[model samples]
Structures are given as C-alpha cells and as structure tokens.
Target: MPGYHSFTANIIYNLAQLGIPIRDSEFFDIQTYLEIVEIHKNVYAGETPSRQATQADIDTFLG
Candidate 1:
C-alpha cells in the first residue's frame, strides 16, 4: 500500500496548496483515502459517480 500512501500524501500536499487543512491521520485507511480521491477525481472531471474519468480528466485533476 506504499503507492496508495504516496498518493494520499500528494493529495494532502495539493489540498495544503489550496489552503485546506487535512491531517494525514484523517484518511484513517487506504480505502478511505482512495474513496475520497475518487470523489475528487469525479468532481474535477465534472462527472457524476456513474461516469468514468478519462485519462485527460485524471491528468487535469493531478495537475
């Protein structure tokens, strides 16, 4: 789960850049962090949960 941990860290870093306060411990577990990430990805893609995100959508969100 190291990769997931790294992903979570990146998300935390990005949120910090946006002036959002999020503690690493708040994620609780990898599943929780992943779910949050998915939700954010969907929002960034301007899609509903039922919609799949394209690579471009993911790239834009990552950037």
Candidate 2:
C-alpha cells in the first residue's frame, strides 16, 4: 500500500504526457488493481514474458 501511490502517480504522469487528462478517480482503486494483478499473475504463471502466457493458463489458475 505504501508504494502504490507512486504507481498511481506514474500512471497519471504517463497519461498526462499523452494529453489525456486524468483525475485521481481515473486511476485504479486498490481493490481493482489487486483484482487485475491477480488476473495477470495467473495469466503469467509458469511462463516468462517471451512465452506468451495464455488464457487457458489463466483459466487453469482461476480454477
């Protein structure tokens, strides 16, 4: 939780550089990020980025 504020700040800065206006509300809430990261972690489990983790893997992990 302590470092998460930095993540949100970086997201805001990146979007702002693209001329996309963002409020703090636009950043993912902690719960949402946790959900998404859980999904991503499952997707990437037992694979490196070069390996292209699959939906099947995600489903398996979710299961």
Candidate 3:
C-alpha cells in the first residue's frame, strides 16, 4: 500500500481543527500540555473527563 502520504512522530496534525491554541493557559494549562496524536493524527477517540483515557494522557504528560 503506497498511494498516500505520512507524517512525523507523535505531534498534533490539525491544530486549527482541534482549537487547541484558543485554550487559555490559565484554564487548560497549555504549558504542561503535550499532545500525543501520532504526528499526523488529530483524532483522539475519548473525552477529557473520561478516566480510562484521560488518566493515560495525564500520565504521559505528567510522567
């Protein structure tokens, strides 16, 4: 399968769509935010308060 393109490491692909830049640093703590979406991927199938997924995300960023 070789007909499309790819991306780099775990980095946010669609910053505009995600509306990440709009989040205030005082609220979402953007300073400590480390988006892990496989580089070109911008789809994280989960919610923020979802313990199952958010916990892992927190662990990854805080750890």
Candidate 4:
C-alpha cells in the first residue's frame, strides 16, 4: 500500500480530466475506488469500443 495514495491521486486526476468529480471522502471507499478504477481502465484503453462504452457509462454516471 506504499503507493496507494499516489495511485488513487492519479486516478482522480484522470477522472477530473474527463469531467468526473470525486470527493475526498470517496477516495477511501472500497466500492467507489473500484468503480473509478474500472471506469479509468475502459476510458484509457487503446480500443475504440472500450472508449466509446466508457463514455456512455460516464454520461450515465454523471447524469
């Protein structure tokens, strides 16, 4: 867990870049953290389909 905070910060930064807002409290929540990780995985993937799917997911999550 040495680089855990750094890793989560990177994920939060990426999400912010994508217009997703994350609260400081949510950072330590296992479910929310996992959800963010899953979203980040798809959004940052090299495949077009994955990106497209993640975009839809982001839209839904935000709405």
TM-score per candidate: 0.40, 0.35, 0.20, 0.35
Please give the CA lDDT of all the candidate structures.
0.69, 0.66, 0.43, 0.71
Please list the residue runs of candidate 3 whose C-alpha ends up more than 4 Å from where it truly belongs after superposition.
Answer: 1-15, 20-25, 36-63
**C-alpha displacement of 21 in model 4, angstroms?**
1.1
Question: What's the ranking of the predictions by lDDT, best on top?
Answer: 4, 1, 2, 3
Best by TM-score: 1
Clash number for each model: 0, 0, 1, 0
Worst 10 residues of 1 by lDDT: 18-27
Model 3: per-residue Cα lDDT over 1-63, one tens digit each: 343333211123444444555434235433344442233243454434445667778899899
| lDDT score, candidate 4, position 57 | 88
Clashing pairs in 1: none
Off by over 4 Å in 1: 1-9, 14-20, 47-63
Off by over 4 Å in 4: 23-63
Top-lDDT candidate index: 4
Off by over 4 Å in 2: 23-63
lDDT tens readout by residue for model 1, 1-63: 769999767977756754546765464666765676677666677854466889998999999
| Superposition TM-score, candidate 1 onto the true structure | 0.40
